[model samples]
Target: MLAWPAWLTILLLVTNLLSLAALFFVTRRMLKLRRQKKRAFAFSDYPVRKAKLEEIAPCFAMSGYGPSPDSEVRFIGGEGVVSSLSDRESWVMAALAKGVKRVFEFGTCSGKTTHVLALNAAPDSEIFTLTLHPDDLAATEFGFGDDREHRDIALSESSFETFYYNGRSSERHIRQIFSDSKSYNEAPLRGSVDLVFVDGAHTRSYVENDTRKALNMLADEGVILWHDYKPGVPGVFAFLNELSRTLPLVHIADTDLVMYRRVRKQLSPA
Candidate 1:
């Protein structure tokens, strides 16, 4: 081998060092993105009303914005479950369940929310939840309109055959449908649902599809709640951020829940 000039050797070493530094910065940036928290949106602009609970007591009190007087609000404690709502989120669900007769849920993961809905809703209330069955996973397809990563994650998380509500009293009120949410028929339920919980796929495409169906199925003055509206969840964060600009989407402070109320549009005067 030929001897290299000392100057040339030093130049090569410096170039290699610079290259390593660049790589280090890029890697750090990627990891930082993974941990970064997105800014939370405001909660006042949406058509949502807060439920009033007496500061001294845990009981809900009558307020202009509180649940109707006839609503039967109940709480089944959050015990063993894969995933469940926070106390704050539970309060919101229980308060809204009062007097509601029809509820629709997009994802039934562990059925924790379904149990909450059934426990608080009226005795005659009916809940319909849609989730993918493990057997149907082979048939599920991801198209150009869907986010492959989100879809895959959803599939992996949808493998539960048993739910928290199974064998419980609330099971009588829940009608679990084992199928892909995209193919579920929302036509018959149009304008009939009192509350809709959209906790399904976190992908942008799935969120869009579920939101469209929820809007169609909601009755006048109905409410819709979405889960996992955090920043690092790219699909959910991006879709919700853009949708909030067009629609009044309120993010509750400190929780991943976002609320949207459907206001009935009055027809133009004849």
Candidate 2:
């Protein structure tokens, strides 16, 4: 057979390149769709506790379900802030705060949640929130064990220069700890906190570290809440998924919050 013409050979090469480019784009699109579906599926893995807003308030109680009288609660928030808690979540947290005496927050993005906690907690309650100042980014030290994706997210969300509670009355109740959570010691907080909110870094390593310390810092009957466990947050979702298997966790329906309660064990029969 005669050799192919130079023009034909050049055209065939270009066609192959175009075909490969199209295949690459199509494959990428499919992978993205798969990831979206996977994230949606993650929220369905745990049980959701559904209740009317009023039903969950600290004051509305029946025979077996009512907050203790000492538990005082008040909710404050809903200014359309992207980083703040949703109205329903704020209410749930406020009701829970009625029973909390010492609260710890892993991240204090704008201090909106912290303000809400202080507003609802007992009059003499105290709050400790950990976060990095915008100025400390250069000096911050993150965990080495975190996955690359998680570490990147944690770094991106670490800045906290302005806060809602900066001059508010609630500020009096809050003790802000400015430091990278990885290097922060848990010794002073161990076994004394009544509520811990893990909303700091979205990385797996940071989540694991914060969770371990939260458990250690928790009082015998304390509660822990983690945020951003919904779709698109892979690190938070993945870690909580593995954790929920062995720990008692309940997802609050229509929200991205998961709660774990440490129940006090009863003494053996006398």
Candidate 3:
């Protein structure tokens, strides 16, 4: 019943709204691509060698520890635990802990890893594990360019005030530090840690900051292990891929851990 002019006007209005909706979605997608491009530009992929377990340390060799005490470790299953490491990864870390005297951990999600480290370390060994205090979440300083999803994950993981090691015999060897890693002082412990585990916030800025401090804390011949190296973790994957260009980093096959060992140079005889 409407005039042709009025019908044409209605069609024009509907077309205009649909065009705007399409433009909005397109703009959103373009912005996402721009952010990803910026991240790629900031951190380029460098080939990281995938290494077998035995290649990283002799303790992992079948000949070296065929059901021996050196490779034995106390372990808790990943059941009901948040962000737990795979069984194989846990065993690898535990075996490595057996030979180290001083261990530094960047993040203690539930103190499960900390407990395992203490249980395997030498009786006199000291373990320092740092995590954000649940009460101090407000003090976290996430960078503007950090992955928003991981920022939320970091906060969620910091919700633990008490950890699995609380009241266990291994707690005697463990020193739990409640402080944001960015504000934690590493000067006193520089060049003294035998092992460093970098598993803090997965955001790029936090990972970079923690890695810098981990390197500073490493002793001669110390080893540094970083968790969550898969491509899904954009911050960790990109940063580590970029880091592999300058450091001898090896991604352990079948696991998400990347490792770097600092070997002392032997002095030449005169």
- Model 1 Cα lDDT, one tens digit per residue, 91-189: 677777776899999989888888889988879999999998888887665557666767778888787899988999999999998877788889999
**lDDT of the candidates, in the order given:** 0.78, 0.79, 0.90
C-alpha root-mean-square deviation, candidate 1: 9.7
Worst 10 residues of 3 by lDDT: 62-71
Reference-based TM-score, model 3: 0.80
- Compared with the true structure, model 1 gives a TM-score of 0.71
Candidate 2 per-residue C-alpha lDDT over 1-270 given as tens digits, one digit per residue, 9 for 90 to 100: 998899998999999999999999999999999999998775445434434333433353543555444334576655576466887678667778774689999989878889889888778889999997777777655556556776665666666677778888988899999988878899888999999999988877778889999999999988898987764676687788788888877776667788888989899999
The better-scoring model by lDDT among 2 and 3 is: 3
Off by over 4 Å in 2: 1-73, 139-150
By lDDT, the candidates rank as 3, 2, 1
Model 1 Cα displacement at 14 (Å)?
Answer: 38
Cα misplacement distance, residue 210 of candidate 1 (Å): 0.7
Top-scoring candidate (TM-score): 3
Ranking by TM-score: 3, 2, 1
Q: What is the lDDT of residue 57 in candidate 2?
A: 37
lDDT at position 85, candidate 3: 85
